[model samples]
Target: MALKATVLKARLNISDMDRGYYQEHAFSLAQHPSETPNRIMVRLLAFMLNASETLTFSKGLSDEGEPELAERDLTGDITLWVAFGQPDEKWLRKASAQAKAVRLYTYGGRTVPLWLAQNKAALARLPELEIWEFSEEDLDALTGWFERSMTFQCSITEGVLYLNNDDESLTITPIRIKDRS
Candidate 1:
């Protein structure tokens, strides 16, 4: 028999000073059998970074044709595509063609720089793509805050993110290595 995906629920109170977006979202996400707590926490971090009323999680990991999370317009057009981890240049090219804006949150520390060095030239060709990388230390810190049921207070200002889980708060600063626009 096939193993089922585990369901995790999260409540996020987000305050984005840069975007002037503030809201609270309560949602559930399915964690695939092959996924780790690190990846799930990264996905949740991505959600808080780009939280929107219309943004919804897609069949990520399960579907290669869709983004991990996306914001669609009323016309059913994908406006923003969000993805986590290191993605192939070929797939990013496809995503750039499909969406008006594409953002990649790449983790895994030192490997990210090497991966970018290998594909930076080709990636620069896509003006819609933005690549942000998280340090392994910071990712590990964020992962420590993960749980099956959790609540977080997030605030973003300038280029830094502050995530508060009860009494403890973690600070994260994702470096932007590529931004054509």
Candidate 2:
């Protein structure tokens, strides 16, 4: 017997002033049994950060070969591969080889420094890889706003994200460890 994934419904209103992109997307995402609320929110944030018609949540945690999220072209060519948490270097290497761009969102507080010290040199060599880190406190605040049926108004400006659920708002600025440029 196995535990089933929980399906979460979300409607996101996005205004990316930096990119001059504005769109609203409504979708359902699955949360694995072992995944925490922080991870779920991270996934949603990743989708909001790279909102596109072709960007979609993949079989994350369940499918090892697939990215946590991906954006593909009409021809089914992968344009971007997005990963959350700290993945093995080999996994990132494979993702870098397969996708046009690879982005990793690393979280988990103090462990991040040690992890970066061990892997930064190897990761820096990957031209397509961009790494961002979410602070534990900020992530905790973001997770505090999570709900099963959620409708969020999200705005991004000057590389900062403002997410509001009407009752509360969270400001998040992910720190970039490595830029694709």
TM values, all candidates: 0.95, 0.96
Query: On residues 51-89, what C-alpha lDDT tens digit does candidate 2 reach at each position?
Result: 988898875477878987999988987899999898899
109 in model 1: Cα distance from truth in Å?
Answer: 1.2
User: By TM-score, who's the top model here?
Assistant: 2
Clashing pairs in 2: none
* Candidate 1 residue pairs that clash: none
lDDT of 1: 0.89
Q: Pick the candidate with the highest lDDT.
A: 2
Candidate 1 deviant stretches above 4 angstroms: none
Q: Give lDDT per model, in order.
A: 0.89, 0.90
